[model samples]
Target: MEINKKSQAGSLESSDLMVYVEPFNEIKIEVESSVSSQHTEEIRSLILNELEMRKINGVYVKIQDNGAMNLTIKARLKTALLRGAKNGN
Candidate 1:
């Protein structure tokens, strides 16, 4: 669980969230957000789509949000992916 490098991106602007992507060809998603239930579901849906599209696993994502928008969520997810890639995910 070491974040050796952080992508050159801004931080999340909402609640604190942590995502762990396992290594595999399957779509496995786990999210922890401080947003409301509806918003959480929305975010989960978006994240699932992203993970499926990217096909990433064996990596973990941790997000500290501050009321981020859809774009922000995408940015944060990409940042985490970049970081995980750099760190040999």
Candidate 2:
């Protein structure tokens, strides 16, 4: 799916994360995490997998994590994508 504009989901509270999505020419992901050094790769992989499953492309994703779990990340990503696609933002 194509993201028409910028959109975001989730929160910055403890054990949560915020996800932002925007239209782009290529897929790019930037992640800022409380545990970046230890879990960056894992979190990136999870996000990529989610996008791949939905056949999403040509978008930029930004994630701010505060010790969230995989499920939370997945949900936030999904919510952000849906909102962006629907609202064209």
Candidate 3:
């Protein structure tokens, strides 16, 4: 789906995350995490994989992670994507 505007989900609480998404000319994901470099790369990889699976492009995503688990990240990403999509409520 095409991201029509900026949207966000989740929070900055420990063991949680905040996902922000907006329209862009390219796929850009920025992650802010206190985790190790390896884990940060893992987070980026996970978001990339999800966007690929959804065929989502030309959007910018920002993730503020507070030691969140994979499932929580995915959930927040999904919500942000939907909220940012043109057809989303």
Candidate 4:
């Protein structure tokens, strides 16, 4: 599916996260984590898997991770993606 516009979910609160989704010509994923660099790759993989599972493409995903677990991040990503795709661009 294609993202129609900019959308976001989650927040920068402690032990939480924020996700931003926008329309783009290509899939772009950016991640910033407060935890540690060691978890970056894992988190990136998780985002990729989630996008792949949902067949989402041609969008930019910006993740600001504040020590959130995979489950939380996944939920946020799904919500943001859906919101971004809600209206036709």
Q: Could you say which candidate leads in lDDT?
A: 3
Model 3: worst 10 consecutive residues (lDDT sum): 31-40
Listed per candidate, the RMSD to the true structure in angstroms reads: 5.5, 1.9, 0.8, 2.1
Q: State the C-alpha lDDT per candidate.
A: 0.54, 0.88, 0.93, 0.88
Full-model lDDT, candidate 2:
0.88
Model 1 global lDDT (CA atoms, 0 to 1): 0.54
Give lDDT for model 4: 0.88
Clashes of each: 9, 1, 0, 0
lDDT tens digits, residue span 1-89, model 4: 77888999999998889999998888899999999998878889999998898788788999999999889999999889888885523
- Between prediction 3 and prediction 4, the one with superior lDDT is 3
Where's the lowest-lDDT run of ten residues in candidate 1?
A: 16-25
| lDDT of model 1, residue 63 | 43
Ranking of all predicted structures according to lDDT, beginning with the best and ending with the worst: 3, 4, 2, 1
Clashing pairs in 4: none
lDDT tens digits, residues 14-86, model 1? 4434343333344445555566667767777787677667765434344444456777778667666666554
Clashing pairs in 1: 13-66, 13-67, 13-68, 14-65, 14-66, 14-67, 19-61, 22-58, 23-58
